[model samples]
Target: LAKTTQPISMDSYEGQEVNITCSHNNIATNDYITWYQQFPSQGPRFIIQGYKTKVTNEVASLFIPADRKSSTLSLPRVSLSDTAVYYCLVVKQAGTALIFGKGTTLSVSS
Candidate 1:
């Protein structure tokens, strides 16, 4: 598994966009980048994913560079409800196990 690096905390304002980046310097070729969001007392939920280039869902967008060493999760027009710990993970194509790391806490204030 590739070790990921992310900011410990980030601050943003309501209705603003937030982009949290995670670095995986040793990412494997078969690995995919997955982003998960967790609230105070809840388990992480799948937010977005991508193998390369860009991927977008209703909640967020994930952008992966060609080298696959890093990825960014983009939240458009975020709100207070979007404040949570965002986790970036590198996983095998068919793997189900998730190893959580110290995630990036996004603080969205009014």
Candidate 2:
């Protein structure tokens, strides 16, 4: 599995757009970049994923550059409820248990 590096923390206000970038220089061709958010005392939940270019879903958007060395998870108009620890993971196979790095703690204030 590829190692992931992300910020230790971030701050944002309600209604602001938050972008967290993760770096995975050893990412393999078959690897997919996936982002998950975990609230305190809860399991991490999938937010978005992308192999290349961009992928968007109801909760968030994943942007992967051509090199696939780094990616960004974008949260739009974030609210206090969005405050959580966000994880960036490199997944190469399905049904594999999620491997987590020290996540980026996002603080959203009103």
Candidate 3:
């Protein structure tokens, strides 16, 4: 599995756009970059995913560079309800349990 590094915390006002970048210097070719968002008590929900280039959904957009060493997740018009922890993970097709470390906590204020 590939290791990812992200910020510990971020602050943003309500109705603002937020972008969180994660670094994965040793990503494997079969690895896919996946982003998850978690609220206080709930388990993390899938946000977006991509192997390379860009991928976008209703919730967020994932951008990956050619080297595949890093990716950026962009959230548009974030609100207070969006305040949560965001995690970046690299997973291969093989079945394996995800080991989550401390994620980036997004604090949305008014």
After superposing candidate 3, which stretches have Cα over 4 Å from the reference? none
For model 3, how does the per-residue alpha-carbon lDDT over 1-110 read when each residue is reduced to its tens digit?
A: 88999999999999898999999999998999988999988989988889999999989999999999999999999999999999999888673877576889999999
Instruction: Enumerate residue pairs that collide in model 1.
Output: none
Candidate 1 lDDT tens digits, 36-106 = 99999898999988999999989999999999999999999999999999999999899878778999999
Q: What would the TM-scores of all predictions be?
A: 0.97, 0.96, 0.95
User: How much lDDT does each candidate structure score?
Assistant: 0.93, 0.94, 0.92
2 against 3, candidate with superior TM-score: 2
- The CA lDDT at 10 in model 1 is 99
What is residue 98's positional error in candidate 3, in angstroms? 1.3
Top of the candidates by TM-score: 1
Ranking by lDDT: 2, 1, 3
| TM-score of model 1 (CA atoms) | 0.97
